[model samples]
Target chain A: MKPTTLRSFLPRPAINQRICISRVSRGYAVQAPGNPTLQVFNRNTKYLQKERAASNVERSRQADYLKDEVAMRLSERLLDINRHFNHVLDLGANSCNIARALTLPDPDIDPSKTTSPPLSTRISHLTAADSSRTLLYRDVDLPFNQEINLTRQVLDDEERLPFEAETFDAVLSSLSMHWINDLPSQLAQINHVLKPDSPFIAAMFGGDTLYELRTSLQLSDQERRGGVATHVSPLADVRDMGGLLQKAGFKMLTVDVDDIIVDFPDTFSLMRDLQAMGESNAVLGREPGGIQKDVLLANEGIYRELHGNEDGTLPATFRMIYMIGWKEGPNQAKPLPRGSGQINIKDILGGGEVK
Target chain B: MPTRISPIEKFAKAAAKCSVESSAYGKCIVVDYNSVHKDKCLTEFLRLKNCYLAAAKKP
Candidate 1:
């Protein structure tokens, strides 16, 4: 990968090694709302080298922490949504969370295999792909159908997937895929890998999810300065997500937003959680960790005034979507078309029509 | 001293065991899910490889 392309590509930080240094159109001058050009802080090369030297062990430790648990549940969920999958591929399967989810037995497993596939029935082959070598090597000793890590990005538009066309039975990406700068292009690449009847699932963070906090920050920024620059890069809406999946040659697409409301002792705890998860938005065009201590305080006040309930615990919302789509193929079931003729309410009532 | 499994090894084992259905890894994971160890089950499951606890709360 060219340095330009590699740097330009949206980063999918492995486990928790996410640190983005933002350099706007101008040099050292950064552009964020409420502040014309904030100073680039803490992310200097020296700092990074120091950080790397300091916490190289911690970086691996973080990856090691949740390997088994994530894989189990993810495997289960994948199994539930995808029936009759012979081959499965997991993208950036960090500690294999979705893979773990896929492993869980399907609730709809047929008893006695009553003219149906048995429950917790394994896929014929499983493939795990990621850019992290430490993570890639972790799976080397483990038992997988066949794990592939040498291949960097399955969605490489230039070469595409190395696997044969119509090869994979299913493809699942959880909390990843959004990191790609060219998401649509990558999605198209993924479409290529999956067999026509395969299932595609992606669980990702969406725009309206952290509305309370985002809105509060915006308001505060406006109050502090004349205008605000975009902080959080918006996610594909539910409708767009479904359309994207469908356009990627998928059918039977479903996008369900799982709104999880979390209670925090205060806003600080929520921010801490986001930090711990390495989920801080990294819009290359946007500025990093806000400047102006007073502005942050003002933002906090705004958040408290608007979103804080009487209990003093600020409500934090994460708008997440559990989406699934099926690859279009000859064997795939076609969807039924809706009748174009409008319904007649008066005729159906019969009270209005004597006949 | 007792055996102190490295967190990396621990998580790797967990992820492998979690995602595998009938794959090579599944055979190793004896999901000791029983009456007394519910939270442990949940935590262990959450910790499973690539298994995302989407709606999981801080217990």
Candidate 2:
């Protein structure tokens, strides 16, 4: 008797139909034309910056502090939902931070014992997508990587995602959406790719991020050069995010803000760290010649005078906006129609007897 | 009604007006990127920035 395979058991017409279906599904990954008016960031420059930062292993490691912290916070938020995601997409994933956070045992838990539930129990498989190839492969050889199913894909967040509709069980992003030029379109795409009622959790820098640095730089420029240049990139306001998510067709929206204040010895150290983190300004039409030394010196003094701690360290504020929205689905909970309630407000409050 | 141009196009047009200064500044920054100092490309930067600002102000 001849050895038989599962594919061989299928009829020839069935195989041809499967191939045709796959081809049609693959063609659904279309790239939408982005609006040019909203192009505030130079994505090419941002990519080059990320590549350059990732070239130095030591510096990049030092710079991973912010991303790591944000990733941990995002993972904690994911765990709160108590839903197990079979397949998740980590959009704009930097070095698989979310994957690492999920797989690695909690610091407070004992490693040998299984008393506390593992965080990775929440996610079965994660697809970590990022624009920078170097950043994506930075931690490929980590030991914890073996514990989870993680796949890395080099993807530009500025462009339309190359995924089929309703492909992801859930989508999570950390400290990446702020760099995007068209956030509404991105959010809609994210919603489109998520399974029904699946959560889309994300964190982005808010408008108040680095305000101290922004003001100091402006003051320095005005005093020295008689005019101020756009030094800091603009960020999304927390107030606008909920509206954007609602407009994107997500239901049960939750938006909150957090501030991470990091202390540095001086301005130069802070700037160096920002550069190493690939968070340097990528705004179009920005000053090509970097900040002038005299202006920087003046800004250092101004920064210290305005916002320096008593210990002499300069504090840089990073305001983060965390948002959670679920894709609309039929099985999800729905609010009752207005005036449909049976109970009276006065009766519920016990202020007056029911008529 | 006049056609409205995108911000990227407007910036691109302004940048084209100051290409010489922009190239000079770009070259300076790229050359000394690794060991760039505070005042490394002060002149080039200021010139390009001023030119671009002036160009951007025009209708």
Candidate 3:
């Protein structure tokens, strides 16, 4: 599929289509009430479905560049926990990357002469869910375990999960949830579906991701276009992850940032890589015509001056934030109630007895 | 909710008044929206934008 701009997907005008100009636009006499702002990253599912389909095709060429690495990292976290996950749900499981990584037989334990249980034995069932049916159906063969049962479902939407309460032992999403507009609501749904004390681990791009590209684009656009437009989608902040987990009633929440930098020959190559990875800008507010040639050429200079290496290659940073939360249950640890601690902080600091 | 000028129309309007400005790095056509529209209503904005695009050379 060809790379798309905002104008490429704009609905074609019908002959009888009614074009209503707002009253506010009639005369500027009295300012009409401003429309409420939409939630950031609030994109239509149809656009995403199409975009993901294109991306899945490109993913074959780039085979495991960013997605596979992140999925493996997320899978390793699950492996380290040493807990038996009977049923695992890979939310936003595009092409079952996470599921495949999680269920593949451990390299250390050979199935032919395995004295110990393989990693595939830990998870009996894997349900892979994604918004794009194109992605789920594109590839038929999977490197999944023969013993494990794998099911694929096209989710209705990210904000609303269709599953019974306490259905999953673990829920994992790799570099997918950042596109969601209502993250807290999504987290609540994930929390509801997870069995008590079960784990929910996710990895997503962080706020500082692609700062080099963003700065260059803004500067180039401001200089050439008189004003800057939204060229890149905003990523989630690491600090906000903890609060969101708590709001969703998840306990033992942990959020960590992993920064990865990839070197590129130039801005053009970098942009090509983004296109190949299916990570190009798709936000509604992005420029309709896409990046102008001049802006891109100008950005190359700025990119090299600031972020370039001695080898004449530039760097692109991808900050992945890993978030882990556990569903609240009787077995989960709880914080101490107010004034319930045995020792007072004042006594320990002052070396004096408490009253 | 009241409808506003869509993003496509806004981009086209911005592209119309564009003039190629040369810099140290390169040159690009910069569209000055403030100079063109000032403070127009949504309806007026779209009308004036269509007119501007119709008259000006395509960016």
Against the native complex, each candidate's DockQ, computed on alpha carbons, is 0.01, 0.03, 0.05
Candidate 3 residue lDDT tens string, A1-355? 9876897588867632444435445665765576343477545633364455455574444644788788878877876688788898989876677766666556455457847554657888888888777766555464453555778898777668989999999999997787777788889999999999899999999888999899777766665566778877887799999998999999988899999899986676677667655466777666666798546645665566556678867888999999999998886687778889898778779977557
Worst 10 residues of 2 chain A by lDDT: A293-302
Best by lDDT: 2
lDDT of each: 0.52, 0.82, 0.70
Candidate 2, A1-355: lDDT as tens digits? 9777697776678788899989988865765775554789988899889889888878898989999999888888876686788999999887788888887665456678878665877678889999999988998988868988888999855458999999998999998888898888899999999999899999989989999999878766765676778889999999999999999999999999999999987777788889889888999989997887556645655576667789978899999999999999988988788999998887769877457
lDDT of 3 by residue, B1-59 (tens): 96676443444344323212112222111233223221212343334335445544454
By lDDT, rank the candidates, best first.
2, 3, 1
The TM-scores, one per candidate, come to: 0.57, 0.73, 0.70
- The top-ranked prediction according to TM-score is 2
> Is candidate 1 or 2 superior in lDDT?
2
1 against 2, candidate with superior TM-score: 2
lDDT at A273, model 2:
88
> For candidate 1, lDDT tens digit of each residue in A1-355?
6445665477776643432333233366555655242222222322232223223444443433223433343454554553566777777554445544444445455687755432225555556665443433433444431322222232222213456677787777766554445556557778888877777777776768788877766654554454565655567677788777777777888788766677775554565445434344555556555435433434444465567778856788766666778778776687657765477767678757365
Chain B structural similarity (TM-score) per candidate = 0.31, 0.77, 0.29
